[model samples]
Target: MSNQLDLFHVQRAYSLAQGPLSNDQLYQSVAEAAGLASDALNQRCEIGRAKAKRSPLKRKIRWYQQTLKAMGVLRKVEGRRGVWELAEPTDKGLHQAPGRVCLLAYSTRLGVAIWGDNNAVFSHLDEPIHLCVTSPPYPLRIQRRYGNVAEHEWVDFITQSLEPIVKQLAPGGSVVLNVSNDIFEVKKPSRSLYIERMVLALHDRLGLSLMDRWPWVNLSKPPGPTHWACVNRQQLCVGWEPVFWFTNDPLKVRSDNRRVLEPHTDRHRRLLEQGGDTRVTHYGDGAHRLRGNGFDTPTDGRIPKNVMIKGHRCSDSLRARAAAKRLGLPAHPAMFPTALAEFAIRFLTREGDLVVDLFSGVNKTGMAAERHGRRWIASEIILQYIKTQAELFSQFEGFWLNPALAVDSPDRTGS
Candidate 1:
């Protein structure tokens, strides 16, 4: 239960190996030292019968690994299984005097892909794109200069935009579209049904299949619908949106669910150690549902629920906002959480894979793509948005990037 020596143990294991360890070797060694099965070491046992919860030890190891990796203490690589090795330290210049160093200046070789129009960008990209993750402007009561279509025209607009995009997908690639329903009509409290309509349109008209849907929740968000939510308290505040995953072939999409596994709670560890649920219970979604045998405490970690809880990084974005103001630019009003892009990227694409964003406002997708070692090309119509985003990226150097250059808009005259 104590995390007193997890780092020490992990570091010692790596020290003994003196080289990268495959997931099997590293996990088995750790488990043997701890007097547990290799798979059990990764198990998250439940703590109680009544409440459904699990342990965090297995998850803690991963968290520590990630933290150490982030701090340059270790490195993790992807392949048949994870490959991890102790990393040598190099000066990141963090301690250097202010304004003396900038990371982006050194990482510019990775190349930055920027375009002003989606159609033009797609036409320009002949290479296959492994994934397309974007949070396009949605139908709303007031038009944002960033270009949201009217409610009635939204589906057609999206269908037309995606026609070229889907063609660029590499075999088994995916598209994750982040969208929310519009509540413009006060009487239609349940929302304007635009989101559902769009999903149907994507399938019926565009030949895209709805693979999965994630409910993205923002806990500390602004209240919605002044009439029903704030004043009357007749409806709960709107706090979630849907991120729809689509692919041409639902049966075969480039997905590695293991990458997005979540940490289990304290209770799950207990159950995992026992190698069985506290009591026999069936998990749903198929006929082969059994609770005791291979069904408990999977070593791959627990699949995250369909609900995604992510908050906008307010502090980080606020700094960007101030910088935008100083530069005489407006911060994007409807930017999705960075994790939205990150989740889709890790879930669907591998390292060095290409990800394209058709409506990449402010380069949130660009930032996430860079973090995951994935190549990225993003298109945004607004020049100021691209300029401000490029300015922000110019300060950091965790990933390789070329300077973002502007391209003449192919449809510059359209709304």
Candidate 2:
């Protein structure tokens, strides 16, 4: 029932094209290598229908080219119809490039993207990072191909990757980690304690202080733990992930709630217009009191609650994936929403402060930083991801806004 587009075939075509290839040459190469239908490869729409539709496979490949053009990697040869030229060699199986760290790309006066393992990259970085925001691979029972570890080893893996970067944090710098909450115990309905264990490890082993745990609510999140949730009905669908905020020094943590405030609700606005509560009231069993004067003073905006709501889809990410498919490229397994990164960047760091993402999947953190006029650095291990995420900075690098806001501006893109 799910006819999802598998990008693997598209990426294969790019891998086979060592240099410029004619339309037929590239199509044939991909069809042969991927064992695609010869008819699908050679199928041509009628001249009238050509503008309206194309063979599904061919159309996908062609549309992907638009993505490549944006990334500045693939281009149609000037005056050579049906011919294309690759700017540089594509990732030959997504292997590491020859170097300790490679500066893959950058935005004008914004940020730098580097290709290398995060641990290795951070070791050589001399600049003190003001914020380290990232979502490392979750600890799942079965590790994914993108280098996530087994549940038992997840803590150690993250600890090692972050230990060096934590040492380099500025005095009041914060580390906000987006971690998985759906991990369950082996063959049971019980949840795993890895999150708690991770918190302890960071505090005990790294000497960091726990600041606050922000809940990222995604109501549109699909159901999971098929065996327990759908079959046995032992558990409910998990709709939120925990975002743990930590800092090197709790008292001096660099954050301001006023910077990331939520718009006032109509009811609250009416209350403010009426000149405060008008009467003193006691709530919480008389433990707390609300005075009329409290609502009389006007403020810029309401302080946002800790529960952040956003969908997973990001416009830039969608564009990157489409481009990646066109170029026959692979993507990071999981990419957090752009709004989430923007929230953290705005709340924790100031303009021109350095923000770093150790496990910069598709470099969403870097994109958020650049949009907010903050300096950024990203380190990702996969060369293909480095290439794919590089598309974010291709055009409108400094002036781009979070596209998620374009459609869902209220409630911060809450579904």
Candidate 3:
């Protein structure tokens, strides 16, 4: 049922490699680790694609290599263009090379993939990422364990953060940012223009183009019961947030509508069967143009609209609660739902593409990527958030996992 590929496995293989390897050598290592023949990677190359002239296998490996080189793990072997060698993970597993700083989490599930800090990590990536699905901690009203900038400065903070990210995108790659607007002035509930300001800054200052704006409709959202909604009743409860899609070049964005089509409505089926609804009606309030309530059916499911409805309940699962209890960790109160991450990933990227999430709390994006077969590089400042969630995605962990991998396990919470 999942329309995903094994991208996670490929990246994991690269991470676990003992030392620097040529592109062919890297693919063979990943393939062997994945329980496939060394030549199994050829299947990806056999299929031609509109976007990439190179084989998917080679492109995927190039991404892996760039990630390694950018992270200061690989370098051209003294003068060879194609040959490379490892420059990091000195026995201690901390990546202390020049131009890159920060100790790696050394996770088993895709070992050596979980990193920290975009400031230290992004500069190390030499290739453009295919997609980036992230739920950035925007300016919010409530205090959180994961910090955010003050409301007044949030727009600038978001814009500045994205500057590096934009440079990391592949030519046809896109970014889907999940951000919620806050009530900056409770006195003037609707006056929070920071989201708008952030959007403008991304476009005007950063030279990024807005591809589309999606409205995430969470039906199971809890009521805020704020002064305006519950007390004065001046505004309705805001149950939706914007998921903005951006790209370096809007004219050539990589998207597959067939990958994320919605089921056709009964009305659509019946109308096409009856060969009816050809009549036109007034279009909205203007009453100038005309349209029909129903029309011919789509061959498959209907093309999805920008308004995506998800009923994922906001409750801790028994497994999550139990893990939190056993590990002495608290569940992440503010985390992106797996379903939300799944939809964005399915819509924007293909199998074998490299996806990155800088804030990677609990790595919902990583989970989605694993299911869909995309390699992901997820990083979080807090090591425990990455550790506690590892159990949920155990298949991707390293083979010779460290016994002390749980060293950061105690008293860890807030994924």
Which has the greatest lDDT?
2
Candidate 2's displacement at residue 120, Å, is: 1.1
Error of 1 at 131 (Å): 1.1
* Candidate 3 deviant stretches above 4 angstroms: 1-101, 106-115, 274-298, 314-321, 397-404, 407-415
Q: What is the lDDT of residue 10 in candidate 1?
A: 53
TM-score to true structure, per model? 0.65, 0.73, 0.67
lDDT per residue (tens digit) for residues 1-415 in model 1:
3232244345445666777877557656655544554456555666556655544555555655564465455677556356888774222211111111112211333336453467655665588888889987888776665656788888898888887888777777898998875455646555687888888998898788888898888877788767678887778887888889998776678888899987766677666777755444565666545555643645757788888888766444665576567545677677887778889999999999988787877777877888788888777655456545665676556433322222112222122
Model 3 root-mean-square deviation: 15.1
For model 3, state the Cα shift of residue 304 in Å.
0.7
Per-residue alpha-carbon lDDT of candidate 2 for residues 1-415, written as tens digits (9 for 90 to 100): 0012223334446656666777667656656665566686556554344475446555655555554445444667788877776655535366442334343444446777766677767887898899999999898776655656888888898889899889899998999999998898988899999999999999999988999998999888889767789999999888899999999998889999989988888888988898877777889898888775767877778998888888887797787777567545675568888899999999999999999998887888988998898999888767567656655566644533222111121222232
lDDT for each residue of candidate 3 in 113-147, tens digit (9 for 90 to 100): 45456656665677678888888887777756666
Supply the global lDDT for candidate 1: 0.66
Question: How high is the CA lDDT of each candidate model?
Answer: 0.66, 0.74, 0.65
Q: Number of the top candidate by TM-score?
A: 2
In candidate 2, the residue pairs with backbone N, CA or C atoms under 3 Å apart (3 or more residues apart, or in different chains) clash, namely 10-328, 11-328
